[model samples]
Target chain A: MDKFTVLSAVAAPLPEENIDTDKIIPARFLKTTKRTGLGVHAFDSMRYRADGSENPDFVLNQEPYRKAEILITYDNLGCGSSREHAPWALLDFGIRCVIAPSFADIFHNNCFKNGILPIVLPHDVCTQLMEDARMGGNARLTIDLPRQVVVRPDGTEVPFNVDPLRKKLLLEGLDDIGQTLQHEKEITTFEERRAQAQPWIPRIVLD
Target chain B: MAPRTLFDKIWDSHVVETLPDKTAILYIDRHLVHEVTSPQAFEGLRMSGRRLRHPDATIAVVDHNVPTSDRTQPIEEAESRNQIETLERNVKEFGVPYFPLLSARQGIVHVVGPEQGISLPGMTIVCGDSHTSTHGAMGALAFGIGTSEVEHVMATQTILQKPAKNMKVVVEGQVGPGVTAKDIMLAIIGHIGTAGGTGHVIEFAGSAIRELDMAGRMTICNMSIEAGARAGLVAPDETTFEYVRGRPFAPKGEAFDEAVAYWKTLAADEGAHYDRVVELRAEDITPVLTWGTSPETVIPVTGTVPDPASEADPGKRAQMQRMLDYMGLEAGQKIAGTPVDVVFIGSCTNSRIEDLRAAAAIAAGRKVAEGVRAMIVPGSGIVKAQAEEEGLDKVFLEAGFEWREAGCSMCLGMNPDRLTPGQRCASTSNRNFEGRQGPGGRTHLLSPAMAAAAAVTGCLTDVRELI
Candidate 1:
């Protein structure tokens, strides 16, 4: 995981709501065991035509936006599927932050784990940011994690809320497994107690 | 003692420890793995030189990319075959119990978990697939997790989590004729919108919910994800106990009695408080279908496609217009009588034996309308065998609907069973997202019986009329 701090870059605007995980990366491209190299296939259907040519109409395919490190979208973004590939693709494509009015629960959590910041703003604020994003590479947005604000191109700052622990973890680039391993003794004790209390909890017997 | 909600009881019992932050380390009792999501997690473990902490607590199956066609033949697609092979190798290396592609028990992870009695009452279950909420119907605290979390669970047998808020959805009154659990769920999503249940765990209660069988309850809980709920569950009762009693992995004899006693205590205490409460009358629900790409874009089968012009919000109107354009539907057009090219009757949401029986009952004496390709893929091999024994296969075959082996065929379109571009379908699958069936495929989600009705009529016909 990469540490996330302050990032100032061009933000692409996709005002559509309910941009599901399938749209981010279709199931067809999910066959790969490795997570890297998915940026090419990110938003595969939208980015490419049926004949495999790039769809120039897409926001990400347009000039300036093609190198965007931030995304501004509408409500319920990333609404379907729990596939972590959605965030992996975004991170692989160099998108470090997503500003939306709302987000689906699983996708929101997945973003924090992958070191991508998912910021929730009011609908009006998101619409305004989307407008600001349409100005292209000239209007770079600054996401200051330590300060917990999104700095607009016009030098305006908008505060956002994030879980304190998640925010801290993201700044340090720490993985969850390492944090969880610290409680190994407690987990072991809990398991022993549960085994005695709920002996009927079925265990897998491999053939 | 103060009253406690069902979620509170399960979550409290699973807590291994609480960090300085409010996040609790919740011990997971079961972890279900599937092909599409587990491969990367296994690779992570391998890269870190970490051993699976509890192989006995995890189970793996290949479903998403496995061909629903002849299992005897080699998989034609190299990528799909490689993905399945990767899971096989990973599971074997990790010493995790696995149901191979050919295993009679092999099916969608959610379907197989409860069928094998691995997902029981008062347990915390996690899967890489979003439909893991389906197992919550078994009175378990089950929800979906990402691959990173999957790796975390595999390494520590627990997941770091902040407890979700409690929500109670109570559906009173009996559903009218032709209204099934699918219809009820669709109605709930339509009423609540896609993000209504976000950040909360919903407990489905009331007379109508209690009246549903285990399969029906599973169907309702399965789509709770579509409503944006973290998870949904029905309290354990005689129905849930009866379903688990004779299962292969369920506790035996006296152990079963003790387990049932514990399961009985898993329900919410009387006068328990909920953070939010939503009440509905089941009688008000109708046979509903998705008219657009999103699950919440649902309307009664008798209704017309919504006109975006009527939407108050400009942003929502634009989204609706885009959905209409992609679905090739005209505003204010009738949803019923819209021609369909295909009918798919299977998925984790509605591929159990009961769902198969419902579709078969409607197809018993009718033929699939001309120009329509209808297929029934059972949920699991066990379900397939049961349907065959009950002669449902003959019914479907005679009705011109292809009866096929069990897997998540045409659900997420990971397999060869898919809708061609520009094809319209009446499907029983959970999602109706753009290209969910296949690229340029338009999906209208409904119940199995409704899908069967559409197959016979070659259109999105009202199931009540056929019944």
Candidate 2:
């Protein structure tokens, strides 16, 4: 998981904007403790017809893109309710990066925290990329996680930005909990101050 | 140097400490919890072996993941059952008050909080959900936090965070016919991009806000989180005090008078200063319908789908094109009467008695469109029971719509209810993200009455016009 290497072939195309998290992984899937294997149920509705057969019309069913690691999407990606499962499912499905025009504030932040690089480009750029991916399964895109550069097959590069702090944490694989632990000394100091300031409160311990 | 606004006063007073990293340690006065996000925080606590530092300050309710179709069985789905059970266990273990499914007061946290007088002026409330900001309408500072932060607040009644700049949005003039607080909010978000409220605590004042009822004020404040603001607030005035005077949690008699006197002090001074001020005329506001994705994608019902080229700002135009392509929407199309296959009229956004009454007025003696699947999911079991008692359920069913039990139903793709793939819906829910209702499902946000109108007319139609 730390290495975060992904292939170009497993990419999928979301035809619409605001691809919400619930759609990526339904709420039922959230019951499980384990985040892995969500890929099997990812886009379950799109993958299955009313008769439960594979819908070839869906982008995931198309050849070559079936195993792609990058997903090309339109603007306002992940626009619905803030469900963390959306990013969890995307990561579970082997997608390390998503190229889109824009993203919802919460979902975009959630994706970054969970180790997915949400690449926001201009609309024309996204359209061009989506068209490229659709024209052939041979089209490839690479997101160098460490470098934060989205490298297109045509040698065109889109330089994306991330919060400097979040970028550092992502490269080091630290979540909010992990980042808090990094400031363990400061937290302890604060806790000590709190203990004295509010002596009536019990010292609650957590692992 | 100047008279402080309620927003500035609240922002300054709550800052316990400011860190080098720019996060402020703000004290929390109240914390509300629901079934979904509370479980993990509770587990995190037990794993760490910590007792809730001050359980009395926190309250828990089971709202999400409850069955909307049936009141009994703790929900048929095992996972939903487990989610509810987990809450019961956590509340028991944590010593927090719990409002279970059948409780008479059980409702959306926002509705339940203000109605019960648990949300009070000058209180800093936090919940594990975004709409937590709805409490801001009472001159309280409230916001949504994550699971880890939930645990943090449970252990310590204070949150470590950054303070926000103050934004005053003055909504002036009288509202037009059929315009509600929902339309005002939708109009606000449409004018300012979703991120417009980023890093600001928006304080709504002016004639329009002052004229709104407490319930209507809540509807406006509820969607403040949707506008990317950390929170939105209204000063405690007569309307605010009257709404809370007789609630279960409010103090009685002279105690209430004392509390009201104290609440009045929390309002902004006569010459309050604001970092940013936005003025909107209420008369100019109209019923809104979302044409594309995102809550900010909303527009006046009289408008058309914005053409990318029509946008003068090149960057904005570029962004619009991206959103359009991703949403699979064509530019320059009229938003009204766009075909819809589903109509949902309940959620935390618009599931109060007022929301139900508004939608029912539109649905009365009318039939829902043929072959269109329309459902009304009450936000809480208590609301559902009240609606049924008043025969609102019959009104909904008479309109060819299904009246379901309380839970977050079609607003999200949770529970058994969902929009079929490729189907479009005019939803009263907050978000209009693609596939938010179901896979390949298209959602267009509208007011409850608008949703009801769409259900009857079989498309995104304005109710005020139909009337």
Clashing pairs in 1: none
**Per-residue lDDT for A110-168 in model 1, tens only?**
99989999999998999899999998789999999999999999999999999999998
Worst 10 residues of 1 chain B by lDDT: B403-412
**Candidate 2 C-alpha error for residue A150, in Å:** 11
> Model 1: per-residue lDDT, tens digit, B182-240?
99999999989889999999999999999999999999999999999999999999999
TM-score winner among the candidates?
1
For model 1, the superposed segments whose C-alpha errors exceed 4 Å read: none
lDDT of 2 by residue, B240-303 (tens): 8888877667667776776677677788888777888899999889999787767888888878
